[model samples]
Target: GAEADKGSLGPDKIGGGAALADGVGGGSALGGGSSASSLALEALVRGVRDDVLALHLDVLNHFQAAQEAQTRAMEEMQSRQEAMASEVASLRRQLSAALQQRDEFRWL
Candidate 1:
């Protein structure tokens, strides 16, 4: 009867005396679990930061494209303005020559 009372169960058995004896009030029971949860939280924060950074890059790209298009339009307008100014100057010279010929004919 005493032998049966003192018999040792397998180490993996739940509620075994050996397992309870080993769990001598360790500082915190969930230390490993808490560390794992903290790591997961840090990972989530990093992922959100990366997403925001990508969005910012996209916005910057769009702004640069718009600026380039505006610059091109301005250059084309300037080119057209220069051509119109040259045409006006040429027409003024032709009008002046015609008037001078008409005055000489009237005097004859």
Candidate 2:
């Protein structure tokens, strides 16, 4: 049987030596795998960022629409309140005139 060669730095080297070096350095499987992983992670992060931004925009749009609806509702309520106030004033004048006529008739 052929003697098993440990690695580029030889079997006497400690802790898997030059074998692990090749795995981490250029032209090795680990190097290619590391670069591929980094690229994939970057792409995933960008996609997530874009998705979050889209969601934020959607939320802002909804809030703006709600604000506009609230403004319209407030305007309508204000107009109704003004109308009611005028009606109340007219009714008060009519009631006062009627009371004055009743008192005059009693006095006569």
Candidate 3:
């Protein structure tokens, strides 16, 4: 749906608008104050609006993808941190056990 809709926005508007806008010229589309001139202005406005919407969609998609990637990276980092914490706890327990054995031997 999106691909198809965006597909329409480009060629038709660029091609048609270029032709009509050239014919309509700059000031006449407004200064002429004719119904035909107004219609051309309306068409130009619609073309610009469509182009802006398409650009907005592109930016939004990029931002969403970036956010998703950031979320995945955060999750991976969290997992790594948790694993390191557990490993550190295990090493501390081992160190305590060694110290206890040394103290007992010293008492003998």
> Top model by TM-score, which number?
2
Q: How displaced is residue 61 in candidate 2, in Å?
A: 0.7
Candidate 1 regions with alpha-carbon error over 4 angstroms: 1-36
After the best TM-score superposition of candidate 3, give how far the Cα of residue 103 lies from its true spot, in angstroms.
1.0
Model 3: which ten-residue window has the lowest total lDDT?
3-12
Q: Give the lDDT of residue 99 in candidate 2.
A: 100
- Residue-by-residue lDDT tens digits, candidate 2, 1-108: 122121122224433334323333442433345567765665565566556655665565566666767999999999999999999999999999999999999999
lDDT of model 1 at residue 100? Answer: 96
Score every model by TM-score: 0.59, 0.65, 0.64
**Full-model lDDT for every candidate:** 0.59, 0.61, 0.69
Highest lDDT scorer = 3
Candidate 2 or 1, higher lDDT: 2
- Cα lDDT tens digits, model 1, 1-108, are 444223323333334333433322231432434466655654555565556655665565566566767989999999999999999999999988999999999999
For every candidate in turn, the CA RMSD to the true structure comes to 26.4, 23.4, 8.6
Clashing pairs in 1: none
Of candidates 3 and 1, the better by TM-score: 3
